[model samples]
Target: MSEIPRLSKERMNGWAADLLVCLRFCTRVPIPALSFEKSTPEISLAASAYMVPIAGALIGAAAAVILWLATRLGLPTSLAALVTMAALVALTGALHEDGLADFADALGGATQEQRLAIMKDSRIGTFGGLALVIAFLARVMSLAVLTEQSLGLAVTVLIAAAASSRSFALLPLYLLAPARTEGLGAATTDLNERLLTITGITTLVIGLLPLFAGASLARVLGALVVSAAATYGMVVLTRRLIQGQTGDVAGAVQQVAEIATYLVFTSRL
Candidate 1:
């Protein structure tokens, strides 16, 4: 009986540490120094996987608040959408954006070896520039459309997309082997299935929040299907292109999944 309480307390402490790790992994939010003294960043990442959707929701909420404030100040929907996107980029330090760019640049390479080399290069190529422009435009247009329909719709969808896309992005991390000896992919590949299940359920619940705000069930379901298909496509493409997964591939998955979800939300159907 004595040991049982101690074990429960220890489990709670581990969970708290994992939450901090998840936040630090996904956002630029500041945490206390004492938090780090008890946690190992890389090792704790997999344990904290279930909390990743929550972290993404936090990012989305921050951006959504900015969107709401800008619109309240009478900013044009388009401009407000742009500001919201800028805040998102700032919050995540453009981590996924950078990865998408690198992945795009790698697409121009003719061989696996060349592709990997291109991905490592810091320079942006024509393909990467085009990818960024097109992706940014699509996201802005989608948000602007939602804002025009209703602020509540826009906010709810944004939070849902941010949370679910990150959860879907983990599919590649789990389904494929790391492309290299060391990196984010290798570090996070060893996931706990029980935790992954928790992550998926948490994301699904958050993704369904738009329904409460009067979104059509078909629309939400369609968005989820599209996001899943998009993620699946990334998995196949990465396997064909590099024969394995990398951090950039995972980032690209998140980016595409996010856009796919937004597109479904804004569609006529």
Candidate 2:
């Protein structure tokens, strides 16, 4: 058998180290030999957390390009938006959607233990199914409206919204305790100052971009404000209801944040 390559033990600068940490948390990419000090991983996780927003922006941008192309090809605004949404789902492997579904099923269950069990079941329940459908429908409608208003603006809003939502999702991870002894939450429980700083900076930058492009500053700010509030609220509620945060809860936060961003932006228009 081929020897497994390990993660480099050599000291990595802040950005590179953070990227590695993100890969560790977001995906199963193994860098066996590489290891960072305890403090390093925590900071890296935060930095990685910020990357979620960036990833959202990239996904949004790509989707917008697609929608724009479709329109040029004579597709209706509704169809273009539908295609863009489908493309976004496929690109991310529906990771957030899965989280949302698992969260809904868990939350709707009869009891706390049942909720936790449902979240981990890996099977789709009626609640989860419904949550997925509703979320998708909402996104479709939101994007369609934006597309009809202005394709360029739609793309800008989508990119900003996606990035901002991911940043919002990290709120629970930062505030709440971990639910289980293992999994991604355990691997990334430590919330360092560096991580917080990086996320904060990224969020501010992304949130402001829409305004410079002539978007309503009030509307964009509303989205960011609501998302931040919702994120904090979810963290508080998760602590009270489930006693801690889980992957599913984090996913739920992301879904809500995304929806909040879209709603806030659409309402402005």
Candidate 3:
């Protein structure tokens, strides 16, 4: 381990600084001279996972603002919601979408090693291309429905869904052995307890905020219950199918969580 920085001043700042680096890595955010001493892999994973909700919150806020503007401009609610969804995808550079596609391709493979090999190929296979289309359509449809019902609720769902998806992705990090010695999976294979705790707290707070905005708390709680179940199920299934987790598995978790959130929201309506 590297020399520990002063805990009093550096701990919180270190977390924030690490999060910014992750944001820059995942998104296009330009941050300045950020450094991490040899922190535990768990810490890095948790920090990266924690950013998902924060980023989701920002994206949700932007979506809400955009929808509000569109409504004021006399656009239909569903159309406004569609535009907002497009903007969110554009902002993130479809990073998760690409992940979802790659995961789909991997899953479509006939064998475990073959699946991992497919995921690493970079070229989108037919399964991947189709999965991307379906995921996007599902997201857009869900947003449109929610916007028609309540813009505020739609925004909350969007943010919560994003955060929870990333939280779901973190489960594989905690439970699975990395498949190879490269990529994000390798970089985050040894996360620490402190980092995991931080991520859990952040994910919970973000995931529940929608409940205060006219969404039923009971339904939100139910969604979380389902998400937890799904996470466990995915972990078990992936272990059996692939012998370990990889970047594709992480992507699948996020995709499933996003869909689960939408399903829970729809049930409440």
Candidate 4:
């Protein structure tokens, strides 16, 4: 039998290290290097999902800053929003986009067995392509609207939307059991109450900090409110489809909520 891994060292490292693990797992962004030996420990990875939103916020801020600079350099709103969205996809290696595609493909599968199998296949399908197109267009168009308003507004929307979407993405994890006995859903069952509280508060505070910094209160609230609605939709879809959650469902939640946030921000309040 394989020797059981100990959480003793993992417990010792605490939040900072866990945050690093979250960064490494969630994105292609470069981070300060952790020591070589303990970089990919299962124990650390298991707990690190709690910090997914923190990673999302950092990634969102970076992409937003890039978009702001492009506009500052006189790029048109459409062009700047385009570049920013591309950067967003690259930063996370399109992690959430791929999930959106998988879940979309699952929609056409007609059975749980077929859907799960399609999700595992590397090729994209018709539904997956359409999902990506809609998701891409929604973000770019909504962001273009915000960019026309102001760079600060654009940045706030992106940061708040991305972070809050990511925060709620973990809901499927908390509410539904894993669909599989292996892979990310199975590996990430260690989100204890204290850890959940930490991430939830971190998501809230980080998501709301820009508001105190003078972001449009109504727009920010709109984004989060719509994101919550989107998350609920995802929960219902996932529970009804698979009776539980998978990594793809979690990713779809993030992307869907993100698009919903941007949509709300672009609406007339």
Best by lDDT: 1
Ranking by TM-score: 1, 4, 3, 2
| Deviation (Å) of 142 in candidate 2 | 0.4
Q: What is the lDDT of residue 134 in candidate 4?
A: 95
Looking at model 4, residue 64 earns an lDDT score of 89
lDDT per residue for candidate 3 within 1-269, as digits (tens), equals: 24455554566765666566556555544556544534423345445565656765665666667777877798887787678778877766777777778877877788988888888888998999998888777877887787788777887887788777777777887788888788777878667677677777888888897787788788888888788788888889888877887777787787778878877887644
**Cα lDDT for residue 11, candidate 2:** 39
Candidate 2 per-residue lDDT, tens place, 146-172, comes to 888777678788888777777777778
Worst 10 residues of 2 by lDDT: 1-10
Model 2 root-mean-square deviation? 6.4
Count of clashing pairs, candidate 1: 0
lDDT of 3: 0.74
lDDT of each: 0.87, 0.74, 0.74, 0.81
- Each candidate's TM vs. the true structure? 0.93, 0.83, 0.85, 0.88
Q: Candidate 2 at 44: error in angstroms?
A: 5.5
Which has the higher lDDT value, candidate number 1 or candidate number 2? 1
Model 4 lDDT tens row, 75-131: 999999999999999998998899999999998888888888888787899999999
Worst 10 residues of 4 by lDDT: 1-10
Model 2 stretches astray by more than 4 angstroms: 1-17, 20-47
Q: What clash pairs does model 4 have?
A: none
